[model samples]
Target: MGEPDVAANFFAKPQHLVKVNRRRRMNIWRSGQGSPTVVLAPGFMAVTADWARVQPALARTAQVVSYDHAGQGFSDPGPLPRSPARTAADLKAALVRDGIEPPYVLVGLSMGSFEVRHFAHQYPGEVVGMVLVDPSFDDMAKRLLKVTPSDQVWIESQFTHLKRCELAAKAGDLRPGTDAYAACVFQPQPDLTEALNKTYHDMSLQASYWRSLASEFSFAARDKADWPLADMPLIVLSAGDRERPPRPPEEVEAIQRVYADAHEQLAALSSRGARRVVPNSKHAIQWDRPQAVIDAVREVIAAVCGGPA
Candidate 1:
Protein backbone atom coordinates (compact mmCIF):
# COMPACT_ATOMS: atom_id res chain seq x y z
CA MET A 1 0.00 0.00 0.00
CA GLY A 2 1.10 3.56 -0.74
CA GLU A 3 2.19 5.47 2.34
CA PRO A 4 0.31 8.69 3.06
CA ASP A 5 0.69 11.26 5.84
CA VAL A 6 -1.61 10.81 8.82
CA ALA A 7 -5.06 12.29 8.24
CA ALA A 8 -5.32 15.73 9.83
CA ASN A 9 -9.11 15.94 9.85
CA PHE A 10 -10.08 12.44 10.93
CA PHE A 11 -11.93 12.21 14.23
CA ALA A 12 -14.66 14.71 15.11
CA LYS A 13 -14.76 14.18 18.82
CA PRO A 14 -11.81 15.11 21.02
CA GLN A 15 -9.89 11.93 21.85
CA HIS A 16 -6.79 11.09 23.81
CA LEU A 17 -3.61 10.30 21.89
CA VAL A 18 -1.26 8.44 24.17
CA LYS A 19 2.30 8.73 23.04
CA VAL A 20 3.59 5.19 23.09
CA ASN A 21 6.96 6.48 21.93
CA ARG A 22 8.41 9.62 20.35
CA ARG A 23 7.19 8.60 16.92
CA ARG A 24 3.90 6.78 17.64
CA ARG A 25 0.69 8.14 19.13
CA MET A 26 -1.88 5.47 19.95
CA ASN A 27 -5.60 6.32 20.19
CA ILE A 28 -7.38 4.88 23.21
CA TRP A 29 -11.01 4.91 24.45
CA ARG A 30 -11.80 4.27 28.08
CA SER A 31 -14.90 3.90 30.23
CA GLY A 32 -16.15 2.65 33.62
CA GLN A 33 -14.25 2.54 36.91
CA GLY A 34 -12.63 -0.37 38.70
CA SER A 35 -9.37 -2.23 39.15
CA PRO A 36 -8.16 -4.87 36.73
CA THR A 37 -8.84 -3.06 33.47
CA VAL A 38 -10.23 -5.04 30.53
CA VAL A 39 -8.37 -4.21 27.32
CA LEU A 40 -10.13 -4.94 24.02
CA ALA A 41 -7.91 -5.76 21.03
CA PRO A 42 -9.58 -5.85 17.62
CA GLY A 43 -8.97 -8.14 14.64
CA PHE A 44 -7.26 -7.46 11.32
CA MET A 45 -8.04 -3.94 10.04
CA ALA A 46 -10.51 -3.54 12.92
CA VAL A 47 -10.77 -0.38 15.01
CA THR A 48 -11.73 0.26 18.61
CA ALA A 49 -15.37 0.72 17.63
CA ASP A 50 -15.53 -2.93 16.57
CA TRP A 51 -15.88 -3.74 20.27
CA ALA A 52 -18.80 -1.32 20.68
CA ARG A 53 -21.36 -3.99 21.55
CA VAL A 54 -19.26 -5.80 24.12
CA GLN A 55 -17.22 -2.95 25.62
CA PRO A 56 -20.15 -1.14 27.20
CA ALA A 57 -21.33 -4.26 29.00
CA LEU A 58 -17.87 -5.03 30.33
CA ALA A 59 -17.47 -1.39 31.35
CA ARG A 60 -20.33 -1.81 33.80
CA THR A 61 -18.21 -4.01 36.03
CA ALA A 62 -14.62 -2.89 35.43
CA GLN A 63 -12.70 -0.26 33.54
CA VAL A 64 -12.64 -0.95 29.78
CA VAL A 65 -9.99 0.29 27.36
CA SER A 66 -10.43 -0.20 23.61
CA TYR A 67 -7.73 1.09 21.32
CA ASP A 68 -6.70 1.28 17.68
CA HIS A 69 -3.20 0.14 16.86
CA ALA A 70 -0.86 2.37 14.89
CA GLY A 71 -2.05 3.02 11.31
CA GLN A 72 -5.64 2.05 12.14
CA GLY A 73 -8.52 4.35 13.00
CA PHE A 74 -7.33 7.81 14.15
CA SER A 75 -4.09 6.48 15.56
CA ASP A 76 -0.85 7.75 14.07
CA PRO A 77 0.91 5.56 11.55
CA GLY A 78 3.81 3.84 13.32
CA PRO A 79 7.26 2.97 12.02
CA LEU A 80 6.99 0.76 8.97
CA PRO A 81 7.28 -3.05 8.89
CA ARG A 82 5.01 -3.79 11.86
CA SER A 83 5.24 -7.04 13.78
CA PRO A 84 3.28 -8.53 16.71
CA ALA A 85 6.20 -7.79 19.04
CA ARG A 86 6.26 -4.13 18.09
CA THR A 87 2.47 -3.85 18.35
CA ALA A 88 2.45 -5.43 21.80
CA ALA A 89 5.27 -3.21 23.00
CA ASP A 90 3.56 -0.10 21.68
CA LEU A 91 0.33 -1.09 23.45
CA LYS A 92 2.14 -1.62 26.72
CA ALA A 93 3.89 1.71 26.43
CA ALA A 94 0.62 3.47 25.66
CA LEU A 95 -1.10 1.85 28.62
CA VAL A 96 1.67 3.06 30.91
CA ARG A 97 1.56 6.53 29.43
CA ASP A 98 -2.21 6.67 29.91
CA GLY A 99 -1.83 5.72 33.57
CA ILE A 100 -4.03 2.64 33.24
CA GLU A 101 -2.80 0.52 36.13
CA PRO A 102 -2.50 -3.17 35.73
CA PRO A 103 -3.51 -6.54 36.77
CA TYR A 104 -5.14 -6.35 33.36
CA VAL A 105 -7.48 -8.81 31.67
CA LEU A 106 -6.71 -8.78 27.96
CA VAL A 107 -9.50 -9.54 25.46
CA GLY A 108 -8.32 -10.20 21.90
CA LEU A 109 -10.20 -11.09 18.73
CA SER A 110 -8.90 -12.85 15.59
CA MET A 111 -5.39 -11.66 14.66
CA GLY A 112 -5.23 -9.41 17.69
CA SER A 113 -4.99 -12.56 19.79
CA PHE A 114 -1.36 -12.94 18.77
CA GLU A 115 -0.51 -9.51 20.12
CA VAL A 116 -2.25 -10.38 23.37
CA ARG A 117 -0.17 -13.53 23.70
CA HIS A 118 2.96 -11.54 22.99
CA PHE A 119 2.02 -9.03 25.68
CA ALA A 120 1.30 -11.75 28.20
CA HIS A 121 4.53 -13.51 27.38
CA GLN A 122 6.57 -10.32 27.55
CA TYR A 123 4.93 -8.89 30.64
CA PRO A 124 3.48 -11.85 32.46
CA GLY A 125 3.30 -10.01 35.78
CA GLU A 126 1.11 -7.23 34.39
CA VAL A 127 -1.57 -9.47 32.82
CA VAL A 128 -3.83 -11.44 35.13
CA GLY A 129 -6.27 -12.96 32.63
CA MET A 130 -7.09 -13.38 28.94
CA VAL A 131 -10.07 -13.97 26.62
CA LEU A 132 -9.20 -15.10 23.08
CA VAL A 133 -12.14 -14.67 20.68
CA ASP A 134 -11.90 -16.92 17.65
CA PRO A 135 -8.11 -16.55 17.83
CA SER A 136 -5.78 -16.99 14.83
CA PHE A 137 -3.27 -19.75 15.34
CA ASP A 138 0.53 -19.41 15.11
CA ASP A 139 1.00 -22.22 12.54
CA MET A 140 -1.96 -21.09 10.41
CA ALA A 141 0.16 -20.58 7.31
CA LYS A 142 1.71 -24.03 7.47
CA ARG A 143 -1.66 -25.69 8.11
CA LEU A 144 -3.41 -23.88 5.26
CA LEU A 145 -0.61 -24.90 2.90
CA LYS A 146 -1.22 -28.56 3.67
CA VAL A 147 -5.02 -28.33 3.43
CA THR A 148 -5.44 -28.26 -0.35
CA PRO A 149 -3.82 -27.09 -3.57
CA SER A 150 -6.35 -24.22 -3.80
CA ASP A 151 -5.38 -23.02 -0.33
CA GLN A 152 -2.14 -21.75 -1.81
CA VAL A 153 -4.10 -19.73 -4.37
CA TRP A 154 -6.31 -18.34 -1.62
CA ILE A 155 -3.29 -17.22 0.40
CA GLU A 156 -1.59 -15.63 -2.60
CA SER A 157 -4.82 -13.87 -3.58
CA GLN A 158 -4.90 -12.08 -0.22
CA PHE A 159 -1.54 -10.42 -0.93
CA THR A 160 -2.69 -9.58 -4.48
CA HIS A 161 -5.89 -7.97 -3.19
CA LEU A 162 -3.93 -5.98 -0.61
CA LYS A 163 -1.75 -4.52 -3.37
CA ARG A 164 -4.85 -3.64 -5.36
CA CYS A 165 -6.32 -1.91 -2.31
CA GLU A 166 -3.13 0.11 -2.01
CA LEU A 167 -3.35 1.18 -5.66
CA ALA A 168 -7.02 2.08 -5.34
CA ALA A 169 -6.40 4.15 -2.23
CA LYS A 170 -3.53 6.04 -3.84
CA ALA A 171 -5.76 6.87 -6.81
CA GLY A 172 -8.44 8.17 -4.41
CA ASP A 173 -10.76 5.32 -5.37
CA LEU A 174 -12.31 3.29 -2.57
CA ARG A 175 -11.66 -0.43 -2.82
CA PRO A 176 -14.38 -2.74 -4.21
CA GLY A 177 -15.08 -4.42 -0.86
CA THR A 178 -14.99 -1.27 1.30
CA ASP A 179 -18.65 -1.57 2.19
CA ALA A 180 -18.30 -5.24 3.11
CA TYR A 181 -15.22 -4.46 5.20
CA ALA A 182 -17.04 -1.70 7.08
CA ALA A 183 -20.06 -3.91 7.69
CA CYS A 184 -17.93 -6.74 9.06
CA VAL A 185 -15.50 -4.66 11.14
CA PHE A 186 -17.42 -1.67 12.47
CA GLN A 187 -21.14 -1.99 11.95
CA PRO A 188 -21.58 -5.31 13.67
CA GLN A 189 -25.21 -4.36 14.30
CA PRO A 190 -27.89 -2.78 12.09
CA ASP A 191 -28.32 0.45 14.05
CA LEU A 192 -24.88 1.92 13.45
CA THR A 193 -24.98 5.71 13.23
CA GLU A 194 -24.44 7.34 9.88
CA ALA A 195 -21.39 9.15 11.21
CA LEU A 196 -19.84 5.94 12.53
CA ASN A 197 -20.52 4.23 9.21
CA LYS A 198 -18.79 7.04 7.34
CA THR A 199 -15.79 6.89 9.65
CA TYR A 200 -15.30 3.19 9.01
CA HIS A 201 -15.65 3.69 5.27
CA ASP A 202 -13.04 6.44 5.28
CA MET A 203 -10.61 4.40 7.38
CA SER A 204 -11.02 1.40 5.07
CA LEU A 205 -9.95 3.56 2.10
CA GLN A 206 -6.54 4.34 3.58
CA ALA A 207 -3.62 2.56 1.88
CA SER A 208 -1.46 2.78 4.99
CA TYR A 209 -4.04 0.88 7.05
CA TRP A 210 -4.15 -1.96 4.54
CA ARG A 211 -0.35 -2.07 4.37
CA SER A 212 -0.09 -2.44 8.15
CA LEU A 213 -2.62 -5.25 8.04
CA ALA A 214 -0.68 -6.98 5.25
CA SER A 215 2.56 -6.76 7.20
CA GLU A 216 0.94 -8.25 10.32
CA PHE A 217 -0.36 -11.27 8.39
CA SER A 218 2.91 -11.73 6.48
CA PHE A 219 5.14 -12.12 9.57
CA ALA A 220 2.61 -13.43 12.11
CA ALA A 221 3.99 -16.98 12.16
CA ARG A 222 7.69 -16.18 12.32
CA ASP A 223 8.16 -15.19 16.00
CA LYS A 224 5.20 -17.30 17.20
CA ALA A 225 7.02 -20.62 17.36
CA ASP A 226 8.49 -19.87 20.78
CA TRP A 227 5.10 -19.01 22.39
CA PRO A 228 5.33 -18.99 26.16
CA LEU A 229 3.38 -21.09 28.62
CA ALA A 230 2.03 -18.61 31.14
CA ASP A 231 0.19 -19.34 34.37
CA MET A 232 -2.92 -17.18 34.17
CA PRO A 233 -6.68 -17.38 33.80
CA LEU A 234 -7.34 -17.87 30.07
CA ILE A 235 -10.44 -18.63 27.96
CA VAL A 236 -10.34 -19.69 24.31
CA LEU A 237 -13.71 -18.73 22.79
CA SER A 238 -14.21 -20.47 19.44
CA ALA A 239 -16.96 -19.88 16.90
CA GLY A 240 -19.26 -22.89 16.64
CA ASP A 241 -21.21 -21.63 13.60
CA ARG A 242 -18.66 -20.30 11.14
CA GLU A 243 -19.87 -19.77 7.59
CA ARG A 244 -18.71 -22.43 5.17
CA PRO A 245 -17.25 -21.18 1.94
CA PRO A 246 -18.06 -22.94 -1.34
CA ARG A 247 -15.69 -25.86 -1.05
CA PRO A 248 -15.86 -29.66 -1.01
CA PRO A 249 -17.37 -31.07 2.19
CA GLU A 250 -14.31 -33.11 2.99
CA GLU A 251 -11.96 -30.16 2.62
CA VAL A 252 -14.21 -27.89 4.64
CA GLU A 253 -14.48 -30.44 7.41
CA ALA A 254 -10.74 -30.88 7.39
CA ILE A 255 -10.20 -27.15 7.79
CA GLN A 256 -12.71 -26.95 10.62
CA ARG A 257 -11.05 -29.86 12.41
CA VAL A 258 -7.72 -28.09 12.15
CA TYR A 259 -9.24 -24.95 13.60
CA ALA A 260 -10.71 -26.93 16.47
CA ASP A 261 -7.41 -28.59 17.19
CA ALA A 262 -5.55 -25.27 17.13
CA HIS A 263 -7.94 -23.67 19.60
CA GLU A 264 -7.61 -26.63 21.95
CA GLN A 265 -3.86 -26.27 21.80
CA LEU A 266 -4.18 -22.58 22.68
CA ALA A 267 -6.22 -23.45 25.75
CA ALA A 268 -3.46 -25.79 26.90
CA LEU A 269 -1.04 -22.85 27.02
CA SER A 270 -2.24 -22.08 30.53
CA SER A 271 -3.11 -24.45 33.35
CA ARG A 272 -6.11 -22.22 34.06
CA GLY A 273 -7.09 -21.94 30.38
CA ALA A 274 -10.41 -23.40 29.23
CA ARG A 275 -12.05 -23.60 25.80
CA ARG A 276 -15.66 -22.53 25.11
CA VAL A 277 -17.53 -22.82 21.81
CA VAL A 278 -20.12 -20.12 21.35
CA PRO A 279 -23.15 -21.55 19.58
CA ASN A 280 -24.63 -19.57 16.68
CA SER A 281 -21.57 -17.37 16.42
CA LYS A 282 -18.79 -17.07 13.86
CA HIS A 283 -15.39 -15.39 13.84
CA ALA A 284 -16.90 -12.06 14.81
CA ILE A 285 -18.32 -13.29 18.08
CA GLN A 286 -18.26 -9.76 19.49
CA TRP A 287 -20.94 -8.83 16.97
CA ASP A 288 -22.94 -12.08 16.54
CA ARG A 289 -22.95 -13.05 20.22
CA PRO A 290 -21.71 -10.05 22.19
CA GLN A 291 -22.99 -11.49 25.42
CA ALA A 292 -20.51 -14.33 25.02
CA VAL A 293 -17.63 -11.89 24.82
CA ILE A 294 -18.93 -9.94 27.80
CA ASP A 295 -19.32 -13.12 29.80
CA ALA A 296 -15.83 -14.29 28.96
CA VAL A 297 -14.35 -10.96 29.99
CA ARG A 298 -16.31 -11.00 33.23
CA GLU A 299 -15.23 -14.58 33.89
CA VAL A 300 -11.60 -13.56 33.56
CA ILE A 301 -12.09 -10.41 35.62
CA ALA A 302 -13.76 -12.44 38.32
CA ALA A 303 -10.96 -14.96 38.37
CA VAL A 304 -8.36 -12.24 38.78
CA CYS A 305 -10.38 -10.55 41.52
CA GLY A 306 -10.85 -13.81 43.38
CA GLY A 307 -14.61 -13.65 42.84
CA PRO A 308 -17.03 -16.23 41.45
CA ALA A 309 -15.83 -17.35 38.05
Candidate 2:
Protein backbone atom coordinates (compact mmCIF):
# COMPACT_ATOMS: atom_id res chain seq x y z
CA MET A 1 0.00 0.00 0.00
CA GLY A 2 1.05 3.60 -0.61
CA GLU A 3 1.10 6.38 2.03
CA PRO A 4 -2.25 6.79 3.75
CA ASP A 5 -4.12 10.08 3.28
CA VAL A 6 -3.54 11.52 6.76
CA ALA A 7 -5.81 14.53 6.31
CA ALA A 8 -8.78 12.97 4.48
CA ASN A 9 -10.44 10.99 7.29
CA PHE A 10 -8.25 11.46 10.35
CA PHE A 11 -8.69 15.14 11.12
CA ALA A 12 -12.36 15.23 12.11
CA LYS A 13 -11.49 17.82 14.70
CA PRO A 14 -9.57 21.03 14.04
CA GLN A 15 -5.80 21.04 14.36
CA HIS A 16 -3.02 23.53 13.60
CA LEU A 17 0.19 22.86 11.74
CA VAL A 18 2.71 25.14 13.37
CA LYS A 19 6.17 25.58 11.91
CA VAL A 20 8.75 24.64 14.52
CA ASN A 21 11.43 25.44 11.95
CA ARG A 22 11.51 26.37 8.26
CA ARG A 23 11.73 22.71 7.28
CA ARG A 24 9.41 21.16 9.88
CA ARG A 25 5.87 21.68 11.17
CA MET A 26 4.25 19.94 14.13
CA ASN A 27 0.56 19.16 14.56
CA ILE A 28 -1.13 20.95 17.48
CA TRP A 29 -4.62 20.83 18.98
CA ARG A 30 -6.01 23.61 21.17
CA SER A 31 -9.07 23.77 23.42
CA GLY A 32 -10.77 26.15 25.89
CA GLN A 33 -9.16 29.50 26.73
CA GLY A 34 -7.32 31.07 29.67
CA SER A 35 -3.89 31.85 31.06
CA PRO A 36 -1.33 29.44 32.48
CA THR A 37 -2.04 27.39 29.35
CA VAL A 38 -1.91 23.66 30.10
CA VAL A 39 0.24 21.60 27.72
CA LEU A 40 -0.16 17.82 27.46
CA ALA A 41 2.92 15.82 26.44
CA PRO A 42 2.28 12.21 25.51
CA GLY A 43 4.50 9.26 26.48
CA PHE A 44 6.92 7.45 24.19
CA MET A 45 5.30 6.42 20.90
CA ALA A 46 2.00 7.96 22.05
CA VAL A 47 0.09 10.69 20.18
CA THR A 48 -2.30 13.54 21.08
CA ALA A 49 -5.36 11.31 20.74
CA ASP A 50 -4.16 9.40 23.81
CA TRP A 51 -5.20 12.46 25.85
CA ALA A 52 -8.80 12.40 24.60
CA ARG A 53 -10.07 11.42 28.05
CA VAL A 54 -8.23 14.05 30.09
CA GLN A 55 -7.59 17.17 27.94
CA PRO A 56 -11.21 18.28 27.55
CA ALA A 57 -11.90 18.23 31.26
CA LEU A 58 -8.78 20.24 32.03
CA ALA A 59 -9.63 22.58 29.14
CA ARG A 60 -12.89 23.40 30.87
CA THR A 61 -10.82 25.23 33.49
CA ALA A 62 -7.81 26.45 31.52
CA GLN A 63 -6.49 26.56 27.99
CA VAL A 64 -5.11 23.11 27.10
CA VAL A 65 -2.82 22.11 24.24
CA SER A 66 -1.81 18.72 22.89
CA TYR A 67 0.34 17.77 19.92
CA ASP A 68 1.94 14.87 18.11
CA HIS A 69 5.71 14.82 18.03
CA ALA A 70 7.43 14.86 14.65
CA GLY A 71 7.11 11.53 12.74
CA GLN A 72 4.72 10.19 15.38
CA GLY A 73 1.30 11.27 14.19
CA PHE A 74 0.34 13.87 11.53
CA SER A 75 3.60 15.78 12.00
CA ASP A 76 6.42 15.75 9.49
CA PRO A 77 9.65 13.84 10.12
CA GLY A 78 12.33 15.65 12.10
CA PRO A 79 16.08 15.25 12.49
CA LEU A 80 17.50 11.97 13.76
CA PRO A 81 18.44 11.09 17.36
CA ARG A 82 15.27 12.49 18.93
CA SER A 83 16.82 13.31 22.28
CA PRO A 84 14.91 14.93 25.18
CA ALA A 85 16.62 18.26 24.53
CA ARG A 86 15.58 18.18 20.87
CA THR A 87 11.97 17.26 21.74
CA ALA A 88 11.90 20.00 24.37
CA ALA A 89 13.15 22.61 21.91
CA ASP A 90 10.61 21.56 19.27
CA LEU A 91 7.77 21.97 21.80
CA LYS A 92 8.92 25.49 22.67
CA ALA A 93 9.07 26.42 19.01
CA ALA A 94 5.64 24.95 18.25
CA LEU A 95 3.98 26.81 21.13
CA VAL A 96 5.56 30.09 20.09
CA ARG A 97 4.63 29.59 16.44
CA ASP A 98 1.07 28.74 17.44
CA GLY A 99 0.98 31.95 19.52
CA ILE A 100 0.32 30.15 22.81
CA GLU A 101 1.94 32.28 25.46
CA PRO A 102 3.44 30.69 28.52
CA PRO A 103 3.45 30.94 32.37
CA TYR A 104 2.12 27.48 31.61
CA VAL A 105 1.18 24.31 33.44
CA LEU A 106 2.95 21.32 31.82
CA VAL A 107 1.58 17.79 32.13
CA GLY A 108 3.82 14.93 31.00
CA LEU A 109 2.97 11.24 30.73
CA SER A 110 5.64 8.47 31.04
CA MET A 111 8.73 9.21 28.91
CA GLY A 112 7.20 12.62 28.21
CA SER A 113 8.21 13.60 31.73
CA PHE A 114 11.78 13.90 30.49
CA GLU A 115 10.79 16.31 27.70
CA VAL A 116 8.71 18.58 29.93
CA ARG A 117 11.37 18.59 32.63
CA HIS A 118 13.95 19.51 30.07
CA PHE A 119 11.61 22.25 28.85
CA ALA A 120 11.33 23.68 32.34
CA HIS A 121 15.10 23.59 32.67
CA GLN A 122 15.53 25.36 29.34
CA TYR A 123 12.79 27.94 29.90
CA PRO A 124 12.30 28.12 33.65
CA GLY A 125 10.48 31.45 33.69
CA GLU A 126 7.82 30.27 31.26
CA VAL A 127 6.55 27.25 33.22
CA VAL A 128 4.49 27.79 36.38
CA GLY A 129 3.98 24.17 37.44
CA MET A 130 4.07 20.53 36.27
CA VAL A 131 2.27 17.19 36.60
CA LEU A 132 4.15 13.97 35.82
CA VAL A 133 1.93 10.92 35.24
CA ASP A 134 3.66 7.62 35.83
CA PRO A 135 6.89 9.39 34.87
CA SER A 136 10.15 7.70 33.93
CA PHE A 137 12.79 9.28 36.09
CA ASP A 138 16.38 10.04 35.14
CA ASP A 139 18.89 7.45 36.43
CA MET A 140 16.05 4.90 36.58
CA ALA A 141 17.98 2.53 34.32
CA LYS A 142 21.07 2.72 36.49
CA ARG A 143 19.06 2.13 39.66
CA LEU A 144 17.31 -0.83 38.06
CA LEU A 145 20.65 -2.18 36.84
CA LYS A 146 21.93 -2.10 40.43
CA VAL A 147 18.88 -4.16 41.33
CA THR A 148 19.55 -6.76 38.57
CA PRO A 149 22.04 -6.97 35.72
CA SER A 150 19.36 -8.71 33.62
CA ASP A 151 17.71 -5.29 33.32
CA GLN A 152 20.41 -4.39 30.80
CA VAL A 153 19.68 -7.54 28.81
CA TRP A 154 15.96 -6.74 28.83
CA ILE A 155 16.64 -3.21 27.59
CA GLU A 156 18.83 -4.52 24.76
CA SER A 157 16.21 -7.09 23.78
CA GLN A 158 13.57 -4.36 23.49
CA PHE A 159 15.84 -2.37 21.15
CA THR A 160 16.48 -5.49 19.10
CA HIS A 161 12.75 -5.82 18.47
CA LEU A 162 12.47 -2.10 17.66
CA LYS A 163 15.34 -2.35 15.17
CA ARG A 164 13.63 -5.29 13.46
CA CYS A 165 10.44 -3.27 13.18
CA GLU A 166 12.37 -0.34 11.74
CA LEU A 167 13.96 -2.51 9.09
CA ALA A 168 10.63 -4.14 8.23
CA ALA A 169 8.94 -0.75 7.89
CA LYS A 170 11.73 0.51 5.63
CA ALA A 171 11.30 -2.57 3.50
CA GLY A 172 7.48 -2.05 3.27
CA ASP A 173 7.02 -5.51 4.82
CA LEU A 174 4.86 -4.27 7.74
CA ARG A 175 1.67 -5.27 5.95
CA PRO A 176 -1.35 -7.30 7.06
CA GLY A 177 -0.90 -11.08 7.57
CA THR A 178 2.84 -10.74 8.07
CA ASP A 179 4.64 -11.43 11.34
CA ALA A 180 6.20 -7.98 11.15
CA TYR A 181 2.78 -6.32 10.95
CA ALA A 182 1.49 -8.35 13.87
CA ALA A 183 4.55 -7.49 15.98
CA CYS A 184 4.87 -3.85 14.95
CA VAL A 185 1.28 -2.56 14.93
CA PHE A 186 -0.60 -2.41 18.20
CA GLN A 187 -4.10 -3.79 18.65
CA PRO A 188 -6.83 -1.16 18.34
CA GLN A 189 -7.50 0.83 21.49
CA PRO A 190 -11.07 0.84 22.87
CA ASP A 191 -11.11 4.61 23.24
CA LEU A 192 -10.22 5.39 19.62
CA THR A 193 -12.56 5.29 16.64
CA GLU A 194 -11.95 2.86 13.75
CA ALA A 195 -10.60 5.65 11.57
CA LEU A 196 -8.23 6.85 14.31
CA ASN A 197 -6.99 3.30 14.83
CA LYS A 198 -6.32 2.99 11.11
CA THR A 199 -4.42 6.26 11.20
CA TYR A 200 -2.27 4.91 14.01
CA HIS A 201 -1.61 1.69 12.14
CA ASP A 202 -0.71 3.55 8.96
CA MET A 203 1.76 5.70 10.88
CA SER A 204 3.26 2.55 12.39
CA LEU A 205 4.12 1.26 8.91
CA GLN A 206 6.21 4.30 8.08
CA ALA A 207 9.99 4.08 8.45
CA SER A 208 10.14 7.61 9.90
CA TYR A 209 7.86 6.59 12.77
CA TRP A 210 10.06 3.67 13.82
CA ARG A 211 13.15 5.83 13.39
CA SER A 212 11.79 8.36 15.90
CA LEU A 213 10.79 5.61 18.31
CA ALA A 214 14.19 3.93 18.17
CA SER A 215 16.02 7.22 18.59
CA GLU A 216 13.99 8.21 21.65
CA PHE A 217 14.34 4.71 23.15
CA SER A 218 18.10 4.91 22.78
CA PHE A 219 18.33 8.24 24.61
CA ALA A 220 15.96 7.11 27.35
CA ALA A 221 18.34 4.24 28.27
CA ARG A 222 21.33 6.54 28.66
CA ASP A 223 22.50 8.12 31.94
CA LYS A 224 21.42 11.78 32.10
CA ALA A 225 22.31 13.88 35.14
CA ASP A 226 19.38 15.07 37.19
CA TRP A 227 18.58 18.79 37.12
CA PRO A 228 17.14 20.75 40.03
CA LEU A 229 13.47 21.66 40.04
CA ALA A 230 14.18 24.53 42.46
CA ASP A 231 10.88 24.61 44.38
CA MET A 232 8.60 24.53 41.35
CA PRO A 233 5.05 23.43 42.01
CA LEU A 234 5.17 19.79 40.81
CA ILE A 235 3.27 16.56 41.36
CA VAL A 236 4.41 13.04 40.48
CA LEU A 237 1.61 10.56 39.89
CA SER A 238 2.55 6.88 40.16
CA ALA A 239 0.56 3.93 38.83
CA GLY A 240 -0.15 1.66 41.79
CA ASP A 241 -0.86 -1.31 39.53
CA ARG A 242 2.24 -1.63 37.39
CA GLU A 243 2.05 -4.11 34.51
CA ARG A 244 4.98 -6.48 34.81
CA PRO A 245 7.01 -7.53 31.79
CA PRO A 246 8.03 -11.17 31.37
CA ARG A 247 10.42 -11.59 34.26
CA PRO A 248 10.89 -13.47 37.51
CA PRO A 249 8.49 -12.48 40.29
CA GLU A 250 11.40 -11.66 42.61
CA GLU A 251 13.04 -9.48 39.99
CA VAL A 252 9.77 -7.68 39.32
CA GLU A 253 9.32 -6.98 43.02
CA ALA A 254 12.83 -5.61 43.33
CA ILE A 255 12.32 -3.35 40.31
CA GLN A 256 8.98 -2.13 41.65
CA ARG A 257 10.58 -1.21 44.98
CA VAL A 258 13.28 0.76 43.21
CA TYR A 259 10.70 2.57 41.05
CA ALA A 260 8.55 3.40 44.05
CA ASP A 261 11.48 4.91 45.88
CA ALA A 262 12.44 6.87 42.79
CA HIS A 263 8.92 8.23 42.45
CA GLU A 264 9.04 9.53 45.99
CA GLN A 265 12.40 11.15 45.33
CA LEU A 266 11.02 12.77 42.17
CA ALA A 267 8.14 14.27 44.14
CA ALA A 268 10.62 15.71 46.63
CA LEU A 269 12.37 17.57 43.82
CA SER A 270 10.23 20.58 44.67
CA SER A 271 9.25 21.73 48.17
CA ARG A 272 5.71 21.98 46.86
CA GLY A 273 5.91 18.66 45.03
CA ALA A 274 3.86 15.65 46.18
CA ARG A 275 3.36 12.02 45.08
CA ARG A 276 -0.03 10.40 44.48
CA VAL A 277 -0.46 6.71 43.73
CA VAL A 278 -3.43 6.01 41.48
CA PRO A 279 -4.77 2.64 42.53
CA ASN A 280 -5.91 0.03 40.00
CA SER A 281 -4.02 1.82 37.25
CA LYS A 282 -1.10 0.84 35.03
CA HIS A 283 1.53 3.02 33.34
CA ALA A 284 -1.07 4.74 31.16
CA ILE A 285 -2.68 6.42 34.15
CA GLN A 286 -4.22 9.13 31.96
CA TRP A 287 -6.39 6.51 30.26
CA ASP A 288 -7.00 4.17 33.23
CA ARG A 289 -7.42 6.89 35.87
CA PRO A 290 -7.97 10.13 33.96
CA GLN A 291 -9.57 11.85 36.91
CA ALA A 292 -6.35 11.49 38.87
CA VAL A 293 -4.39 13.17 36.06
CA ILE A 294 -7.02 15.89 35.77
CA ASP A 295 -7.07 16.52 39.51
CA ALA A 296 -3.28 16.74 39.63
CA VAL A 297 -3.30 19.37 36.86
CA ARG A 298 -6.06 21.27 38.64
CA GLU A 299 -4.11 21.25 41.88
CA VAL A 300 -0.96 22.46 40.18
CA ILE A 301 -2.87 25.22 38.39
CA ALA A 302 -4.40 26.26 41.71
CA ALA A 303 -0.99 26.27 43.34
CA VAL A 304 0.37 28.43 40.53
CA CYS A 305 -2.56 30.80 41.01
CA GLY A 306 -1.67 31.03 44.74
CA GLY A 307 -4.93 29.37 45.74
CA PRO A 308 -5.78 26.12 47.54
CA ALA A 309 -4.10 23.09 46.04
How high is the CA lDDT of each candidate model? 0.78, 0.85
lDDT of 2 by residue, 137-241 (tens): 887678889878877988998888888999999998988899999999866777667776677778888889988898989887763636778778899999999
The candidate scoring highest on lDDT is: 2
Q: RMSD (Cα, Å) of candidate 1?
A: 6.1
Q: List candidate 2 stretches off by more than 4 Å.
A: 1-14, 186-192, 223-225
**How far does residue 67 in candidate 2 sit from its true spot (Å)?**
1.0
CA-only RMSD, every prediction: 6.1, 4.3
Query: In model 1, what lDDT does residue 30 have?
Result: 83
Least lDDT summed over 10 consecutive residues: which range in candidate 1?
A: 1-10
